[model samples]
Target: MSTSDRTWDVIVIGAGGSQAQAMLAASARGGDVSRWLAVDRAWRPETKATTEALGMTTTALDVLTSPQELRELLGSGRLVANLAGPYYRTGTVVLDAAIETGTDYLDICDDADVILPMFERTEAAEKAEVRALIGMGSSPGTTNVLIRAAVDYLGSAEDVDISWTVDVNDMTDAAARHFWHCFNIVDPDGTIHPAPSWEQLERKTVTFPGTVGTQEVIRLAHPEPITAPRFLPVTRCSNFGAITPIESLVVAWSLAFSVDAQRPRPDLAEVTDHAIDVFRTYRETRPATPRIGSGMQIDIHTDGNGLRFSAGADTEMAEATGVPAAAGIVLLLDGQTPNAGVFSPETLVPADFFTALRKVSRGGGGLELHRLVNGEQTERIRIRDLLSQTAATPA
Candidate 1:
């Protein structure tokens, strides 16, 4: 095939956001540059410069409304790393195209509604010989893997608690959409649950040391609760999002109320866009302290042999999200994942996922792995140290 007609080894959708950039950079960190490409509806100069600097070119392909175009685009790529969201709207479109075109896929989707439906496409993906890994980002991705690690450590898990702190100082459309979607969950009563929820608040004192230490986290229906139980044999699973800059809670609730009251509204995208613009301007006038970090923690409760234990991993969000995502892409490209099927990160990522991720994130002695027996901390491990042990051991 001519160079113009050749398929790209990796195609990243939505190349504008920080997370997407991080993901793309991580993908390029230890891989061939000629085979990677980035796609977005349109490119800002900075985004173009950023991708170019990383040794990848950019293209403008607005395929959101064009399924045939999406199919063709995905067909021309070996693996598609979709970073566009709120994924409730764009996920299935790209995923459907990937399966139809026999293209492997990975996404940082954390929507509970999208996850179950994505899982339902398993048969189709398998039949098409396409491999897919869903929710491969921080909270759901890293948390899910950590919970599995804990489960293995405890023989089995009884309960799993996932929590993360998202500092929304950026005030960009991407950040706005993230918070907006968090409140898009429909309750059993058919009402939209207000997020940054004060009613269902949980006061978590610091158990781990980090930037997000000691905060009031609220219940924001996340995919981890819905999907983690399927793999871990847990009776209870819950996920929480603790938002920084407490005032943002008001903004989240207002957006939720407006969205809920206008049920059947087709202009939801416009609304979010407007809110983002408003917040962006507000942020410009009142610049907040630049946040240096964000993190995720997974705490698992397990009972076996009349004893209870807690085990988990704690790492900054960048390593937690970007590294796993990059690792998934590497595994997919390296044929380390399943032959064919739609699967969650926890399901397909091998035990070496952390090791692969640590290498990609360059997280030397950074990620803390811990296990507590009956509330008394017993084991503490650094990820780099753990990986060294893994590497030294015979397979």
Candidate 2:
């Protein structure tokens, strides 16, 4: 029942350095920082110093190549945060290792193609008595948990619409690659179609909090529609979002069509570089597009009654995504969540989720809630005030 002393309480796989750092900071805020480990494919002096600032040790690792070594370091601990990306490639690899080593797992996986396959591991995870939580990042993360809360608050849940927006200034190579690769659609019944995520993009307007005001969003292939139907009775669920400053989007889309069309997609570094050049070029001439970070709005309806929740304004991609993931981590560490089975974030207790998020994010994650009566905003409320109604309102 014992392994080497190299074990860690939590290991943050730094495929996305920003996300990994955010998680480390959050963990430091939540509890002991000594047991945390920051990992990447190669050692970078700057990264090592960053984690050290947060009081955590760092190491370089290619988990894909060194499974046994990774397993040893993982050491069947509290959990492994798979902050790696283009989840289509790295999701299952880290998850398999986590399950093999009897370590709990979490990730911000938003790829449509991977959810069903991961869920298929439910039996395996439960049998191994290890838990796994997927899609715990911003949109799929906070968005999914809020949907469950709204469903409970509104007394019924159906016909959910989730929309998200991220400032182009915060975009990363992995995020950009996901934008192109996530073109495949997932049905409410868990059937992923052979359609493109951007196929027939429909533009619609949504009002987000603070500087986000109202912005146009279109349907993009995401995991919500694929995974939500497995738990909620919503006849329809879909994901829509964009990396803003539509200026850069044009160049990105143009490049994506060419890059993705190649039988062997070119190194995504090309897309990231092109995106930066276009945004930098336009920033000088294009009218200002506020760098207010990212925002998410989820519309939930049940028996025609609707409710909406949103948070944004000056929050970057890493914090927006990593905070929720950190909250999920705290729950697992403190035994706030069950220790068996593979499941989505929505399955976690909403109040506990928000509570953990509030602690890690240091201010409730900038969340605001509202009640929509007959499709019109009728009342405004706070998360604490709304959660107070849980006991009074019979589920």
Off by over 4 Å in 1: 1-6, 185-197, 200-208, 261-269, 287-292, 303-320, 375-395
Residue 200 lDDT, candidate 1, scale 0-100? 48
Error of 2 at 365 (Å): 4.0
Candidate 1 Cα lDDT to native: 0.66
Instruction: Tell me the tens digit of each residue's lDDT in model 2 across 70-138.
Output: 877677456899987868778888888888888889999988778888888889888877888899988
Clashing pairs in 2: 183-197
Candidate 1 per-residue lDDT over residues 15-75, each given as its tens digit: 6666788887777776766678788887889988988888887887765877787777787
**lDDT (C-alpha) at residue 234 in model 1:** 69
Candidate 2 lDDT at 348 equals 74
Model 1 TM-score on a 0 to 1 scale: 0.84
TM-score, prediction 2: 0.88
Residue 13 Cα positional deviation in candidate 1, in Å, after optimal superposition = 1.4
lDDT of each: 0.66, 0.73
**387, model 1: CA deviation in Å?**
7.2
Clashes of each: 0, 1
